[model samples]
Target: ITDWKLQKEGGAWNHCSSSVNHGYLRAVIIALYKKGFTGKDIAASKIASKSTIYRIIKNFKESGSIVVKKASGRPRKSSKRQDRLLKLIQLRDRGTTSTELAQEWQQAGVRASARTLRRRLLEDGLVSRRAAKKPLFSRKNIRDRLIFCKRYRDWTAEDWGKVIFSDESPFRLFGASGKKLVRRRQGGRYHQSCVMPTVKHPETIHVWGCFSTKGMGSLTILPKNTAMNKDGTNTSSESNFSQPSRNSLVTNNAFSSMMEHLAIRQN
Candidate 1:
């Protein structure tokens, strides 16, 4: 009919796919009725059932509007003030938990459920949780670090070039020594079973050396028998143990002896 073609062009029939837009069913029934189409014909057209079409026509004639009345249910717990309070909490204390926000709001005389606050915060574009990293040092630690910077400020280029930078780090032979699973919640107990049996492998050691502008020095592997005392002093046992065999060792020492042999050959 004329009305049916008009509605198809106006995109009114598209709303019928949604339960929330059931009001569009009324418009369809009204258009069919105005074109002198009977209930049987309307039902046969598959727009809606006979009873649904009748109800829509009756409601449309009574109310003059196509809006369906809201169904009765449990009312919203949060008021406008509570919504604004939720937004304020998010803006001021982002990444806070719903339970914490609920408790704080309760103390402020605006009692709301944690679930309600959480829903409101999400609706207001605020994420419910985040992982925050606490800084390792404080302002006092930063201020004290300036002492090292000041001590190195006046060094000449040659002095800076001669300075060595070295640090020690533990090397695990079997890879990482600790558990790898991460737990998100605080105080949550994690499974502590060892994934692999711990076994001692051949000990490995690394020594790195570097100078300031000239770049790194050659790496020297230390003997496994080498050990440092508790006070960082080298013990005599390690010194003697690191020495080469009698045949390889020279009285003049390898470094000076090699230099002398090279000089004698050049002469």
Candidate 2:
């Protein structure tokens, strides 16, 4: 007590550094008691509160140890097995929302709130994020794509040079590549729900063009009501060709110009 020091700041005593270790506190209390110091005197030394001093002395006397025993609290709502089941449910359908997952989990005998489910998923390293947007492909489309790939698999670049590649694409004015959120682990980018299927016909303007290995072609912007013919023929003058009398069957000015340009370039 005689060698004790306290820090002073702003003309006031700050007792922040006065906190001592539990074992050191117990030893100090015991030492003071053995030295015939009363509780008030021991507390006056500014070592600890009178309550803490008394509690430490009582603990040491009754339990022969100043260490506090552990106390049990509320248990977890979910068990390990239930946690694993929750992970499986999420993996089954990564696009399922928390509420939807909760409903599905009810069938599996686990009752938990959406918030709790999210917490459990986070613990298992599963994150809910916007799913990647991908073009919707039907079974027929997939089969056709496979066949096309197989058919062209052996074609060399020179062989492909003879073929003309043409397509019409609609450019959207206010289109957003929005995505859906899904729960998935790392390296699950290509998972079923993670790859969003899109089937949207957004408001756009159709632009037609064609290209070959030798040269490129002019782009023709079609009118709003222009319906492109499937048999390489223009349906009407609404297609806005440069000349409708140049050829009756093939009236696509862009396609004709592309052929003429490619022919000149080839010569």
Candidate 3:
């Protein structure tokens, strides 16, 4: 009789006239009853009303636990295993719409509606979010970036200062369009699975610029669809910054050569 504890089983509460005691308070009530305290004594002890105490004792005697019986209702439509399977399917493709999910779930023998699917996902900590926009990277781009990092991982601050970084970027004359939705948990906004990859839009213009510890380099506008070589040659300008110098460390790219030249001249 000493083992009564708060039950973790999920169930609807039967409507009752009095607020039910739970946890330690319920434990104390049962303890007093086991100690031969009368229902009147338990009530007079200010624990619960006489009827409530008597009901508790009756329930405890008849049922091994004092947990209030749930009000009878229709059972859950899906089993725990089905719910888990639904979660797995949703995670397999975060972009799947709830309607699409419902169709897939029906194939798996769980005929839940889109609303029900959303409810189940919410219970499992998955919510729909507008996917974060990330620049699409090719395998070659990723490999080159990794190589670049490893090559310069040990470079000092001064070494970096002597290097000018430049890159060309496209800006859409209009604006970025549309959004995609993905299911994700909290704090996973930038997860690869939760991102929408994008490339340069068609109706856009490209601009190339360079900067270094010395100062900002000249801003140069390039023709639409102009190819930018790694050596920074095809889109060269008459500006002094674009002229390659012998002090170039990494590339003949205008920025590197100019920054290195400036560094040498200053020294």
For each candidate in the order shown, give its overall lDDT on alpha carbons.
0.56, 0.65, 0.67
Better of 2 and 3 by TM-score: 2
Cand. 1 TM to true fold: 0.43
For TM-score, candidate 1 versus 3, the one ahead is: 3
Ranking under lDDT, best-scoring first?
Answer: 3, 2, 1
| Regions of candidate 2 where Cα sits further than 4 Å from its true position | 2-41, 44-46, 54-75, 103-112, 172-204, 232-267
Which ranges of candidate 1 are over 4 A from the true structure?
1-28, 35-51, 58-80, 83-135, 138-140, 150-162, 171-179, 182-211, 218-267
TM-score of 3: 0.51
| lDDT of candidate 1 over 126-160, digit per residue (tens) | 76554655335466544444544455558787664
lDDT of 2: 0.65
Candidate 1 worst ten-residue window by lDDT? 229-238
The pairs that clash in candidate 3 are none
Best by TM-score: 2
TM-score leaderboard ranking: 2, 3, 1
TM-score of each: 0.43, 0.56, 0.51
- Give the Cα-based TM-score of candidate 2 against the true structure: 0.56
Write candidate 2's Cα lDDT for 1-267 as tens digits: 433313222223353344434555577677767688777887787767889978877776788765667767777778898889999989988999999988887788877899999999999999989886544557765555555556656879766665555567666544445546788999998988677655466556677765556565567676663535545333323233333232333234334444444443466
